[model samples]
Target chain A: MTIDARADRVTLAAVAAEARVSISTVSKVLNGRADVSEATRERVEGLLGRHGYRRRTSPSSAAPLIELVFHELDTIWAMELIRGVEDVAREASASVVLTESGTRHAPGPEWLEGVLQRRPLGVVLVFSSLPAGVKDQLRSRAIPFAVVDPAGDPDPDVPSVGSANWSGGLAATRHLLELGHRRIAMITGPEDMMCSLARLDGYRSAMSNAGHGVDPTLVRFGDFHVQGGHDIATELLALPADRRPTAIFAGSDLQALGVLEAARRQGLRVPEDLSVVGYDDVAVARWSSPALTTVHQPLRNMAQEAARLVLRAREGASVSTRMDLATSLVVRNSTARLVEPTEA
Target chain B: MTIDARADRVTLAAVAAEARVSISTVSKVLNGRADVSEATRERVEGLLGRHGYRRRTSPSSAAPLIELVFHELDTIWAMELIRGVEDVAREASASVVLTESGTRHAPGPEWLEGVLQRRPLGVVLVFSSLPAGVKDQLRSRAIPFAVVDPAGDPDPDVPSVGSANWSGGLAATRHLLELGHRRIAMITGPEDMMCSLARLDGYRSAMSNAGHGVDPTLVRFGDFHVQGGHDIATELLALPADRRPTAIFAGSDLQALGVLEAARRQGLRVPEDLSVVGYDDVAVARWSSPALTTVHQPLRNMAQEAARLVLRAREGASVSTRMDLATSLVVRNSTARLVEPTEA
Candidate 1:
C-alpha cells in the first residue's frame, strides 16, 4: 500500500502558488513562524489545513484513505455494506475510514469540517443525503464523494449507487401472490425515504396487476428495524381471523425476522399458517429459522460500486453518476402455498 | 463538542522550546525556508511532525477524534462493539474513526504510521494484539491506547477491558449439567485465543466437578464463526447413536445457530432430541428458532469501558490497567430437562 505521495506534493505546490509565496513561507505558517505578517500567516494556514498538507517523510506507505459515512452503525445491514466497501478499497490499495453522521440523514457541520481537515481522497455516504452546504464545501476542497443508497433522489450531479428497490418489492409481492395469498400485507420502511416509497409502489403495482385493488389499511410504515416490524406485525396479526392476511412482504430481512417472531407469539407456524418474503438476503437470512425467502439485493456490490465511483472521480475520470444494481428473488422455506380452509 | 485546544498549544510550545532556537527560526524551517541551516531544519522538522503541531484557529470546535481499530469489519459482533464505543464517544463529544487492521491480530506498521500522523486523541483496539515496537512508538509519541478483548494477555502497563469469559462458560455448561446432560459437547473458538482457552478450561472444570471426565473426541476448536460451528456440529451429529452427545455448548451465538442448522438437517427437534447452550446472547439469540439459552457477556458494556479507560488515560488520570465485567446465564428455550430412555 503506497501513500498517494504525488497528491501530497501537488497540495504543497498548490498552496505555495495560491499564497503567492515561497514554499518556505507556507512551511513557516505551519511551524508557527512569527516573522511572517499576520494576514499572510492566516492565509497560508487556511490553505494548509484545507488541503491537508503534511510533511511527507516516507515514500512507501499505506494507500490513500477513503471516508465512509453512515447515519448510524448499529445494524448488521451496515456491516454488509462495510464489507463490500472494504473489498473494493482493499483491491484499490486504499484504506477506509468510517464515521457516523450523528444524525439520520445529513451530517453536522462539525463532522464535515473534520472531514475536510483530514482530507480523505474521497467519501462514500451510505443511506445518507449530502446537504447542499456540505456539497459546496467538498467541491471547494476538490474532494470527490459518492452516495450508496441515498435516502432521497439525489441531485443529478451527485454520483450514487443503489439497488432496484421497486423491482425487488414487486418480485417479493409477486412471490406471495403466486403462493395463492390474496389478503396479503406489506410492511415497508420509513414512508419519507425514496427507496421505501419505491418499494411500496412496487407492491401496489403487483397487487393491482393481480386484480386485487390496493388496500391502504393493510400497509404499515416502519423504521426498517426489528421493533418496527414487530410492532406493526402484532397489530396486523391481532385483526379478526377472517380479515387477517395470510402472507406478508417485509421490506427487509430484519423485519421479516420480526414478523416470524410475531407469528411464533401468535402460535402460527411459518409457511403453513403465514407466508413471509423479505428483502436484502443478508448473511443472517440463510441462518434464519426456516431460512428467509427474500429479494436478493446486492448490498456488497452496491457498496463496491459506490467506492469505485468515488475512486474513479478522484482520479479525474468521467464516470456515470448513477448506478442501479439488479435484484433477484431467492426461494427458501419462508414461503409456501396457502392451504385452503376445510369445509365445516 | 469542544476540541482539545490546550493540547495543540502545548505541542507547538514544546517543539519550539526543545529546538533551542528562536520560534521564528523553527517557523522558517516549517515554511521550507532555504536559509535555515540543514542541521537546524532537520531537528525542527522532526519535532514538528512527531508532535503533530497543527494550527488552532478555532476556540470552539468538534471534539477530538478517537480511532477504533478492528481486525475485520464483517461480523455483527463487531457492530455491537462499535455501538458501545460510539455511545461513550458521543457523550465525550468525540468522533470515532474506524479502521480495519486487515490482519487477524496485529495492525500493520504502515497503518500505525498513518494513525500517528492523524494524531488521534486516543485509540481503542478490538480483538487485536499490540506489538512491542508499535507500543513503544505510541508511548514515545504520548498517544494513549486501550485494548478491548485483547487477542492475548497484554502487558501489565497496557490498559484493557474484557468480559468474564471463564465464568460465562462455566455457567453455560453448569446449566446443561443441571438438566441431566452427562454426555455434553463443547465447541470453542480458536485454540490460540486466550478467551477460547479460558472458555474451554471452564467447560473442563464443570465436567470434572460433575465426576464426568471429558471426552477428547467431543471437543472441537473453531474460528468463532457460523460455519465453524456448523461443520463441527455436523461431524458430532454423524457419530453412532450411542456415542452422540445429548447436549452441546457453543462458544458463540453464531456457532449455536450452526449447531441448530446441523440438528435440523438430522431431523432432531431442539430441547427434545438435543439440548444446546450458546455464549454471547446477542440480539439474534432472542429471535432464533425456539430462542437460544446462552450466556450474556455484556459486549456493549465492555466496549464502553474500553473507551472510557482510553479517555481517562488521555486526561492524565491514573486508572486500573485491566477491567473484567461480570457475565451471567440467560436461560431461554434452547435448553431443557433431558428425557430418560425407556426400555424397549
Candidate 2:
C-alpha cells in the first residue's frame, strides 16, 4: 500500500466515492446535518486527510497545542496546577499536553531530552528548574517557552509566570507574628529549589522587619509531601513544650496537612496552643477539618497566564515579557489570635 | 509556497538544505537532543514540515502517544479519570493528548471526527459510548482504540476496558442490606448512560435476592453531578419523615456527596438517621466530612487495561477480547448499623 499523503486529504468527490453511498451522503457527513449511515461517515473521514479536507477547527484548538511538563509531587498539588492549566488552556482555545517530567524525586536529562524532541508548539515548565545545558539548548532552538513557577532563573531569556513567593512568605510570617507568637518556627521545601530559598528569605525579612532575631534552631527542611510535613512537625512538637514554637508556617499545603495530623496526634489544640499556616490554597484547603488559613497563590490563574504567554510567544511575541501575578492571604480556622505573655 | 504532495517523502538531507542547516543538526532538532542551537532547530523543522517531510520509519515513529477524550463533565469527575490515564500512560513511556468529546447535553455528530483526524497512535474514550457509527469508522480506518465503560457493545470487534459497575452497584446495595436496612432507595444516573443502567441493575438484583421488593417510587433519576443527586434526594426527603426510605444508594460518589449535603440541610445525621452508600469512591469520597462508605471502582486498573488494549489494538488485534475489572466495597463512617425497630 503506497502511502499517498494527498489521498488522505478529502475532497467532496473523494468522500462521496469512499462512502459508496452518494454525494449527498458525503455532504451530510461533513455538514453533520443528515443521518448518513455511520459506516459511510467513517469511510468518508478515512479519506479526509488524503483529500486534504480541513474540518473547521474547534475553539479548543484556538492556538496551536503546547505541552506542559511537571515533576510529580503530591496528588493534590499536581491536580491544582493542572486545574489552573486546563482553565487557561480552555479559555484560550489552546490545548496543553500534561506529562510527568518523569521521576518522582528528580527528572533526569533524558526526560528533558524526550520532551524537547516533541517540538511542541511551546513548553510550560512547572515547579521544576531548567538545567544549565537545557537552557542553552532552548535558547539555541529559539523555542518559545514559559516557566510556571520554575525553581530559579533557569533562563533569563525565556519569560516566566509565578506568584511573588517572598511576599507570600512575609504575609504568612506577619500573620503569625501579629498573633503574639514570638517563638515561631517554619518548615520549607528542598534546599536547592529557588522556591524554598525565596520563601525562606521572605520569612527572614518578615521576622527582621518585626524586630526579632532569626532563630536558626527553629528552621527545618523536607521534601514537599504530607509525610515530610508530619515528620518535621513531630520533631518540633517533641521539643520541650516551652521551647516549642507557638506557630508554624509550612511551605506547602501538603506539609500543612501533615502538621495538622501531627498536632492532632500530640493532642495539641490549634489556636489555643499551636497555630499553622500553609502555602497554596489547593481545593482541600477549604475542606480540611480546621479550614487552613494559608497563602493563596492563584495557581489556576498562573497556569492560565502561562498558557496565554506561551501562545502569545508562539504567535511571535517578544521572549523577554515576564508576568508575575500577586498572592494573597486567606485566613481560615487553622490560625488563632496569639495569647499575650501574661495569659500564657 | 507550493503545497507538494510528493514532498511529504523528502529526506533529511533535503530538509537540511532547505533550512540551510547540517543533516546532523536536523537529526538533533527532530530528536529533541540537547546541544543544538534553537535558531537552527526551528529553521530546520520548518523547512522539513513546510516541504512536508514524512516522519521517517524510525524508533521515534513508534513512540507511544495516547489521545484521551473526556465526556465534557465537571472537573470533579474528570480529575480522577485523567489522573488514572496519566498514571498508566507515563508508565508506558507514552504521552497523553487531552481533549473533550463535545458538550454532554449537546454532543455534535462530528465528536469522533476531530479525534480521527489527529491520527493519534491510540485513543482512550472515557465515560463515553461510541455511537455505532463511530465504532464502524474506527474499524474501517483500523485505528487502534479502546472505550472506558462504554454503554453499548463495541461492534464485537473492538476491545473495551472498564470497572465492573454492575458488581459495584450490587456491593453497595448488599452493604446496605447487611446493615439491616429494609427500605432503601436509589438515585441513578441518566438513562442513556451504561453506568447508570448497570448500577441500577445491581441494586435491583441485590434487593430481589435479599427478598426485598424494589419500589419504583424509591428510585429517582439523576445525572452524576452533585446537584442532580441533591435534587433527587431533596424530593425524597420532602415525603413524610416516616415514609422516607431509611437509606439512599447514590449511583456515583459525587451524587452521594450531594445526598449527604441534602440530608444535612434536613437536620439528619448520616448512618444514624439515613444511611448512604455511594459509587466510584473518588478521591473526595475518602476526604469528605463523615467520610463516605463507597464502592471502590478500579479506575487506575481500568486505565492501565485500556492503555494496554489500545497498544494491542494498534498492533492489529481482533476485538473479541475485552477486560472487566472487579470492584470492592469501601466501608467508612457514613454508614451505620440499622437500628432495630423495637429499639426505636
Candidate 3:
C-alpha cells in the first residue's frame, strides 16, 4: 500500500483518473445522471468515497443553502416554524439563513438586495407578501421560493403552505355552540390576511348552520397579538350585562391570553363565567392558567412541508403549488358547559 | 436643472466628481476613516447623502453584515437576543445573518466554513463556546467577534457581554430570606457555565451572610429549560413535608414556569405553601400565572451592548474585553410573607 504524497488532498480529477473516466463522466455519476453506465457509476463512486473526495466548491456543486425570512422573530410561533424548517434542512445537509424583512407585509429594497447577493438555493417566507417586482426578480434568478401563511391571496404561480384555517375556525365555534352557548364573540387576525379571512368565514358558516344569525357587533378584528386581544376583549367585556357574550373565540393564543387578562380584571372566572377558545396551541398554551383549549394549527408541519416543497422546486421536480395541512380542536380546561342566566 | 442620463443609478464616482474629491477620499468617508480633512469629509458626506450614492459593490466597500450564531433558536430568550441585535444592526445600516451552531457548546466545522466564506463584518455568538482553533482562524482574518452570555470562562482576550449574575442571584435570595423563608432551594443553569456558577456563588454568599449554613442538598443544577426545572422541582417538592424547602429560586423565567407547574401538580398554592423567585424577567414572566416575581436580567441590553462592541472593534477602536450589565429584582405577585407551620 504505497501512499502518494498528494493522497491527503483528494480531488475529483484524481478520482476521475483512477476510475479511468472523463471528468464529465465522473461529474455525471456524482450528480446521479442517468447517462452514466451502472458499472462506470459504481467504480467512480467507490473511488470517490474511498479517497474522501467531496464535490468541487463550484456554484453548481456546493451544498444547497436556504433562507427563511420573517417579519420578526419575537414569538413562539416563529420559533416553531424555524424548528420545522431546520429539521428538514438538517436531513438534506442544507443550511438555513435567517433574516428579518423589517416590515410586516413585505421586505424592503435593501433586504431584497442582500438576499440577491447571497444567492441562496431557495427561500421560505413566513407571513409575508411578495411584490410583483420582487417575484419577477426571484424568477429571473431562477431561485425557488415558497410562502408559509402568506399575507394575502398569493399569485397562482407562487407556492404556499398553510393549515386549514376555515376548518379550524368552524371546529372551535361548533365546540362552543355544542356546550349550550348562543352569545359567542369572535376575534380574528388582520382582515387583509388570507388565513384570517378564511377563519372568519368558517366562524360565520358555523353560526349560520346553527340557526343563529351572525352579529356583526360581536365580531372584532385583532392584530394577532396579546395587546390587541386584550384591548378588543376589554371593549367586548364592557357591554351591558344583558348584552354580554358568555364565550369568546380568540384568533391566537397570545390574544387569548389578553382575553384572559381582561376577564381577570372584570373579576370573571374562566369556564365558570366566561368560556374561551384560542387558536394555535403553542407551548405556552399548556402552561397558561386553566390550560387553554385551542385549535392545533400544525405550524411546524406546515413549515416542514414548505421547506420540502422549495427544495423540490429547486431540483426542478414537480410539486403542488399550494399545500394545506389539517387542523384539529384540542379540548382543555378553558371551555365548559354554559349555565343558564336563571341559574345565576 | 437637467437630470443626468444615469440619474437612476448613483455611483461613488459621480459623488466624488460632484464633491470635487478623489475616489479614495470618497471611499474613506464611506468607511468612516479618520485621515480625511474635516472640510473634505463634510463636503463628500453631503454629496453622498444627496445623491444616495452608496459604496460600490466591491468586497471591501460592500454593505456591512453581522452574523449571529445561536446554539438553538427555540427559546424566547434567543428571540430577545435576536431582537436586540437587530435593533442595533438596523441603526448602523448593517444586516444581521442568523445561523444555528447546531451544537450546544460550539459550532460545527461546516458552520465555521460557511461563516468565513460569507466574510461578515463581525460575529455575535449566543451561549456558545469558541474553540482555540476557531478563535485563531477568526483572528487571522481580522474579523471581530463577541459572545453573549458565554457558556464558560472565555479567554481573557475574547470580548463578551453578560448580566450581573451574582447580584441578581443575591437579590433574589435576600428577598426570599426577608419573607422569612429559612429553608430555600436554588435551581441554577448548567454547572460549567460561568453565569450559572456566579449565580450559585451569590446564593451561597447570601446564605452564609444570613448566618445559615448553605444546604448542599437544597441546590440543584438545571439545563436552563422548562423541562429541567419541572423534573428537578418535582423531586424537590416530593421531599417529606418537614424536610422540603418552603421556597425555590429558579435561574430563569422558563424554569420558574416549570416550578409553578410542579407546585400546581402537587396541589400547592404559590406564595402561600411555596414561594418562587425566577431570573430573566422575559416578557412571558408578566403573563405567567401569579405573575412571577423574578430578577430582571437585561438580556436585550446585553445583546445590544455586544453588537455595539463588535461594531466598534471592527472599526479598529479600543473596547473593553468584557462588559456586564446591571440586573435588578422585580417584585410581583409570586412571592408573599411566609407563614409559620403552626399557623397553617
Candidate 4:
C-alpha cells in the first residue's frame, strides 16, 4: 500500500522483487519477448504499473515509424486526420503505421504486442482514452502517445488534442441569429458524447445572451448523421407556421445535408424560407448545393498537434497536455437574410 | 548483355560475378543493408534487373505488414482505398504501413530503402506504374506488389486493379439518354488520363447507338476536380437557350458537385431544368443535396482485389494480373425525364 516511495524510484529490480520474479523475466515482458509465460507476464506488468516503472529510452527502441490507430476510419474526417499525421511523419522522415483496431474505445492486447515489438517513434490514437493495461504496456516500452479527441472528452492524466466544440456551436448559432432569424433550432450529436452536451450548452448560452428563451421543442439530440438531421428537421418543419423555427443549426455537416434534404422535400427554398448552418466544415460542406454556412472543426490541425505532441513527448517534454484548437465560422451560401417576419 | 539464358537461373553468385563484386557484397545490397557502397548497390541492382534475379522467399522476409503507398492522400477516394486495404489486412491479421510518396507518381529512393528494410508481406501502390529500378529492387528481394490504378492506364507486365471506366461512362450516358435527353453534354476528366479518354469514348459510343451525332461543343476535358466542373458547367449553362444541353454527364463525383454548384449559381433547378450524372459514386454523391445519379466505380473492391492479389503472390501464386471490376449506375435525384422538348 506504500505507493509513493516506489513510484519515485521504479527500477526493474524493484518491480521484479515485488512481483516475486527474476529481473530477466520482467525484462522479457518489457521487450514483449514471446518465450515469457502469460501468467508471469501479467504479474510483472501489474507490478510495473503499480510502481510507475517508466522504461528507459534507447536508440533502437524508437523506430522511424509513427503509429496511427483508429477504432473505425469512418467517412471524411478520418482521411483528413490521416493526412495530418502523414504530413508530420513525412517531415520527420518517418512512415506511418495505420491500424483499425476494431470498433472499440481501445485496441486489443494483440495490437499491444505488435506495438511493443515495433517500438514506433510515437503513437497517435483517435480515441478519448486508453485501457489501463494498454497504457501501462506503452509506458513500460517507452512509447509515447497522444489522443485526438474530436468528441471533446479527454482523460485528465493523458495528453490529448481536441477541437473547440462549444465555440463551434456558439459561432454556428450566432451566424444564424445575425441573419435576422429570431426563432432558431439546434440539432446536436448523440446524448452520450461530451461534444453534444458542450454544443448544446453553447447553443443555450447564445440564445439566453440574445435575450430569447429557447423553445424546448426546437432543440433535438441527433446521431450526427444525415438521417438524424432529416428526421429531426422534418418534424421541426411540420410545426405550425408561428412555431416552426426560421433557421436551424445542424451540429455536423452530414446533418446539415439531411436538413437540406428535408427542406427540399417540404418544398421550402433554402435561405429564401429557411436558413441553415452546419458544424464540422468537412469537404461535403463545401460541395453541398448552396455550400454550407458552418463551423470549421480544425480536425486536421488537431491530428497534426497530436502527432507533434507525441513526438515531443518522446523527446522528453511535457506530456500532461490537453490542448483544444480554435474553431471558426465559415460563411458560405447556405445562410441568408430573413425576408419574412419571424414572431415565433 | 546476355540476358536470355541468365534470366532462367539467377543467383547471388551470378549477380555478384556480373556486377564485378563479391557474393557477400551482393547479399548485403540484396538485404538492403546500408554498409554497401552506392556504386556497388547500383551495379548489383542493375545486374539483378538484367538477369531477372528473384530472391528465394523466406519466413523472416515476409513481415506481417502490408505497405500502402500513395502520391497524395486527397479528399475522399484515398479513404475508401485505405479501408479496403485495412479490411483485407485485418482479415489476414496484418497491419497496414501507409506512405505518402510526395506528389509524384512513385516514392523515392529513401522510401524504397525503408520498404526493403521492413520486408513487408506485400506492397499496394496507388499509382499507374512503378519505375523500373523500384520494380527491380522489389522483385530481387522477392517483395510482392500490386497497383490500385483508379486511372484507366495499366502497365502491361505488372499486376493492377482498375474499374471499368469506359463501361461506367457508357452507363452514365445511357441513363441520361434514356430519360429523353437529346443534347447531353459530357464533362470527362483530364485529356491525358486514359480513364478520361475511355469514359469519353464510351459516351461517344452510347450516343452513336442512340442514333445521335456527338456534338463537339457539348464535350469538355476537365481536370476531374470541383473547380473544373463548376467552370465548365458555368460556360455550358451560359450558351444560347437553344444550344445549352439539358442533361450533363459529369465524369466524376467531384465534377458533378461542381456541376451542381454551377446550376445553382445559374438559378437552374436540378432535374427540372438540368439533369446531372456523376461518375465515381463517392460518398459525397449520397450527401449532395440532390444526391447525384452516378456510375459506381468499385474503388473499394478494386483495392481489396489488389491487396488479395499481392497476398496471393506472396503465397507463391501468379503475379501477372490485370483486373477491371465492373461499374454500375446508381440512380438518385440528380437525373430525371425532360419535361420540355430537347431537340437541340
**Evaluated with lDDT, which candidate comes out highest?**
4
Worst 10 contiguous positions by lDDT, candidate 4 chain A = A1-10
* Candidate 1 residue lDDT tens string, B226-327: 778989999999988877989999998989988987887787878788998888888888777768999998888988898888877777688688898999
Q: How do the residues B10-36 of candidate 3 rate in per-residue lDDT, one tens digit apiece?
A: 466787888888888876655445577
TM-score quality measure for candidate 1: 0.76
Cα miss at B189, model 1 (Å)?
2.3
Lowest lDDT 10-mer window, candidate 1 chain B? B54-63
Best by TM-score: 4
Per-prediction DockQ, in order?
0.31, 0.14, 0.21, 0.79
lDDT of 2 by residue, A119-215 (tens): 4556777744566545544443334567777344344555788778888989999999988777889898899788788888999999999999978
Each prediction's Cα lDDT score? Answer: 0.78, 0.70, 0.79, 0.88
Instruction: Show the colliding residue pairs in model 3.
Output: none
Give every collision pair in model 4.
none
Superposed Cα deviation of residue B12, candidate 3 (Å): 33
- Fnat, model by model in order, equals 0.38, 0.26, 0.28, 0.88
User: In model 1, what is chain B's TM-score?
Assistant: 0.81
What does each candidate score in C-alpha RMSD? Answer: 8.5, 15.9, 16.2, 4.2
Candidate 1, residue B153: CA error in Å? 4.2
Error of 3 at A7 (Å): 42
Interface RMSD of 2: 4.6
Task: Specify the poorest-scoring 10-residue window by lDDT in model 3 chain B.
Answer: B54-63
